[model samples]
Target: MTSLPPALLRPLLCTVVLSTPLLANAQEQRPGVQAGITFGATTGAYAHYDDKPLVLPALSWQGKRFFASPGSLGMNLYKADGLRLSAVATPYTLRFKTDDVNDPQLRRLHSRQMSAMVGINADYSADWGAVAASVKREVSGHGGGVESSLHYSYPIQAGRFTWVPRVGVVHSSARLLDYYYGISDEEALRSGLAAYKPGSATSPSLQIAVSTPLGTKWRATGVVANQWFGDAVEDSPMARRSSQTSAFISLMRAF
Candidate 1:
């Protein structure tokens, strides 16, 4: 796969860094827009890849029937009795450049490019917690495949801050996993690594987020997350660890 130029890659990296969804417990979902900046870092899952630092703009909007966030956009198709249905589009962020790898052999492999995903989402909210499920397909001509996820989150009030704990599972189709992690015959020959073909995989993830108001117009949020890879991804020669850890913080002002 051809690597994206630095000009395009930078913006995409920004999207990845700012992809964290806004905690519903943190603020009221009113018709408004927020914009600011975020600073964060990540210990990515790829072999020979160093920890990455992130700085990106934070932007989001919510309305009666429409919503937009850092890397995604959606419109509510149905909403009633605490249940909602929507159509959404987001970006797949498991992308890396050959030059980003430290190992010589890994650097010889082809780069993985990002793709856009489009699909539908169903969400239900209650006093106990919130549950959401979504199914998406790669729509950017990058080895088309489907991905799906289900998640649940509960929010707690701690003093002036709202804390949210979330758990989720994500499933990736064979084609999607192979596009990002598989070592092809040509790549294996060039890098001198054994060729690998991964099947579909499902991974689990956990996350905790906290948010508070900075002032009348400013708000701050921070998050920590961990994701465990399934056998299909962990067994890849390009995998560095069975799990990945990441964190981020943001400050935004409403307009």
Candidate 2:
């Protein structure tokens, strides 16, 4: 399959993941437009990538059975009380900037690029937390990989703040790993690096999120997550580290 250029890939992913609302999750209270700014950072996975910070807009909309948020979207196809099934879209919006990597060979590598996936998600929600499972495949980048994950989260209330802790495991196919990290024969010849292929990989991740009300019409939120990539991704010649970390904090005003 012909893959899209990085320039074309991003907007396509955003449109699919952030522009549409989900069909279900009736309890979601996305009243009015919420807008904010987020400041965050991620540790690079490939060689030579230094930790970099990102500042971007945060926006979301929620209603009856649908919700659209930056980088994530869902439409509940079916909902019965707290147990719901929905069609979901998620863009793995993360990418690497290779300009400053330590390895000249790896620097010759192409941009890690970006992709979006679509699939179905199932969730069971309660006062405690939620159990969720999903499967999606890369649609925009044509990474030719599919992912499946199972996740669980619990929310703990503390005064004016609510904290949620989540843990999940994601499994990706070999094709996906190769597309993102593998060095092709041509790339090896041009970059003077041995060709390497990392097969399918599974990663386990943990995340924590906190939200607090800011007086009347504003809210503050923060989240950080870490994932340990599987050996298939870690062992790649382009990898500088096996683990990746990301952080975000934002304040939003409801319209």
Question: What local distance difference test score does each model get?
Answer: 0.82, 0.71
* Per-residue lDDT of model 2, residues 1-255, tens digit only: 877666444433332322112111111246557887666656666666555455556678766678776667878788888988878787754454455456777777776666778899898989878998888888886576888988888878899988878898989898877878888898899899989888898899888878888988888777777889899988888877888776667777788
Model 1 Cα lDDT, one tens digit per residue, 129-187 = 99989999999988898999999989899898988888999999999999999999999
Top model number, TM-score: 1
True-structure lDDT of candidate 1:
0.82
lDDT, candidate 2, residue 51? Answer: 53
Model 2 misplacement above 4 A? 1-29, 96-102
Taking every candidate in turn, the Cα RMSD to the unseen true structure, in Å, is 3.9, 6.1
